[model samples]
Target: MQVTTTADPAEFMATAGDWLVREPVENNVLLVHALDPNGVPPGDREPVFATVTDAGAVVGTAFARSPYRMTISDMPAEAAVALAEHLAKEGEPVPGVNGPTGAATAFSARWTELTGQRVGNERAQWIMRCTETTRPVNPDGRPRLATEDDQDVVAEWFTAGMRDSGLSPEEILRRTQHMVGGQIANQRLIVWETSAGEAAGAAGWNPPLHGVVRPSGVFVSPNHRDGGIATLVLGEVVARALEDGADACVCTHFLKYESMLAVVEKVGFRRLVDVVEHIYE
Candidate 1:
């Protein structure tokens, strides 16, 4: 197997685009980057992209950059190990790796052997899908599109959500600044309001690709968690996306977040695959 590296998103897409869409759900992150207008080198920091080929046909792909853990797509175990060796040789300080269970496990193990960096933590993730959602019970508040006036608090909740999910501090800050505004401007983010019209929580979805839409994420403040805010907002967003022509909705969440699991369950998401995220020391 040969692993090719590139800093250009277009080049990377050109090389592995076909392989990526072949298993879109498993490669959702990469596909979103390829199909986005937010620019793939988010925060203007270039990511390390790897494309694996055997007999000159693309077989696998992965990427690593600061503020985000390395993530691999459907690939052979050997390809994943080869990617670990390639990253080690290039000397990128990958903070962690997350992806489909098999590739992530193979890559993390080889990375430990090659660079002596131990796996600091392993978080199991659930990839869930909703083809049709059950209507969420109303929580006294309704969902509305976020606007510029709501940017500050939305960014705040975005950061809080990232922190709660154990994202690195730099990542939380970067995404708060770079992503929140875009989400609002594109009308992709939703705000759940109180009966008095106060912002109680937020949720959003990516533009559909291959008939699939993935929720960017959802969050309700501590004081408002009891109101079922997340379920109501996310369910509305998914329902709207389906009405807008998306065939299905998808989301990835840590298994530890029981609240999120329950919220998703209330809206009819069923587990599709098991994912893993391994942190490095």
Candidate 2:
């Protein structure tokens, strides 16, 4: 297998767009940042993209932005190893890897073998997809787009939801702002509010790609945890996603979050795959 690397974001998208689009939900995070059509340029450290070809056909792809996790498609073990070795030799400091569990493990192991950096299983999450709309038995509120005034609250909730992650507070704040801002700009950040004008919960979906919309950043404040507020909010988001022309609505929640998992399942989302994040210092 041969891995071709590129520094030009446009070139990488041109080369891997079709491949990534083929499995939009499964590759949602990668495509959203890599193909960022919002005219956002790469940060101080340029993002790197790679395509693994075997016998003249692209078999896998990867994207790595410094100080952030690297993401790869479900590639063969050999291809994973090749990509790892290439990144290691190129002196790329891959803080972590995220993708299909098997592929991620394969790449993480190879990176450890090559660079002597120990790998830790950071987290695992389930990728769920919904094709039909679902509604709570007794929906309490309607879903609406979040306004700019809601930014601070939305960012706070997002940051709180990420508390268990390894990101420093500063990193979390930056990421939350970027994510929430993007969702707001796209008018995709949805808020479910009570009749009393209280925001009970919120959820958002990435801009649709290849007919698929990825549900993300679903969170309910601690005070609103009970009474199935999350279900009503997520159900509305999924239903709207379908009505908005998305052929599928996909999402990921930590495997250990049984409550969220049940909510998604109750909303007609079928589990597709388990994604694991492997981190290396």
Q: What is the C-alpha lDDT of each candidate?
A: 0.82, 0.82
Candidate 1: residue 21 lDDT (0-100): 81
Give the per-residue lDDT of model 2 (tens digit) for 172-240: 777788888888988989988887778988987777777888777888978888868888888888888
Q: Lowest-lDDT window of 10 residues in candidate 2?
A: 35-44
Off by over 4 Å in 1: 39-45, 137-139, 164-170
Per-residue lDDT over 93-160 for candidate 1, one digit per residue giving the tens place of the 0 to 100 score: 78788888998999999999998889988999988888898656575778889889888888777787
lDDT (0-100) at residue 102 of candidate 2?
Answer: 85
* TM-score against native, each model: 0.94, 0.92
Candidate 1, 268: how far from true, in Å? 1.4
For model 1 the TM-score comes to 0.94
Model 2 residue 126 lDDT?
Answer: 76
